[model samples]
Target: MRAVVQRVLNAGVTVDGECVGKIGRGYLVLLGVGHGDTRAEADKLWGKLRGLRINEDENGKTNLALADVDGEVLVVSQFTLFADCRHGRRPSFTDAGAPDVANELYEYFLTLVRQDVEHVAHGIFGADMKVDLVNDGPFTIVLDTDSL
Candidate 1:
């Protein structure tokens, strides 16, 4: 599993001109599930993200975790994170998990996140979504379960 985590002042997801999920003062997470990803991988990444101390403290130091600030989360499924572009001009998504399995894991990941943050929101699993966000501090982080 891979996730691109971005701190945002506010975020929302729209599908067919209808807003589905939204949040304020939180993280916008673009998550991808690989072919070999399992519940364990999802669990690990969720825990890591929840505890990640990227938010600033009262002294302006980046030392506060999402939990510490009572932040929300907006998770969006993005299989393109597994794209392999080393070859030709076109990128390949062979490493991405099948939709059936990927959707299941995606829901599982969301469940884990909601366990900690009640304000967790998510985009439609396989729908065409338009995401909007006001990135806070322009703080962005990429996390891959394989690296851990």
Candidate 2:
């Protein structure tokens, strides 16, 4: 599992001209499930994400977690995070998890997130989505299960 976590002032996802999910003052999570990924990986990733302290404090220090600032969250399925581009000009997605399994883990991860977050939204899995956001401090973090 991999996730590109971006702190945003606001974020939303649209599908076919309809807004599917949206959030305010929090993280825009682009999640990818790769081959052999499991619930354990999701669990571990959530643990890290939930405790991430990137929000700022009164002293302008990035020391506040999501809960500390009453933040919302928008999650989107991003299978392309696993794209293998080391070979030729074209990127290969052979490393991404199968659709069925990937969706399952995606939902599972969402469930975990919703349990702790008051306002959590998500984009449709396997759908073409347009995401809009104003990045806060333009702070971004990339997390991979292999490195954790």
Give per-residue CA lDDT, model 1, range 40-132, as digits (tens): 999999989998899999999999999899899999999999999999999999999999999999999999998899799999999999999
Best by lDDT: 2
Alpha-carbon lDDT, every model: 0.96, 0.97
lDDT computed for candidate 2: 0.97
Model 2 vs. true fold: TM:
0.99
lDDT of 1 at 39: 99
Off by over 4 Å in 1: none
Tens-place lDDT digits, model 2, residues 1-148: 9999999999999999999999999999999999999999999999999999999999999999999999999999999999999999999999999999999999999999999999999999999999999999999999999999
List candidate 2 stretches off by more than 4 Å: none
Question: Cα-based RMSD of the predictions, in order?
Answer: 0.6, 0.5
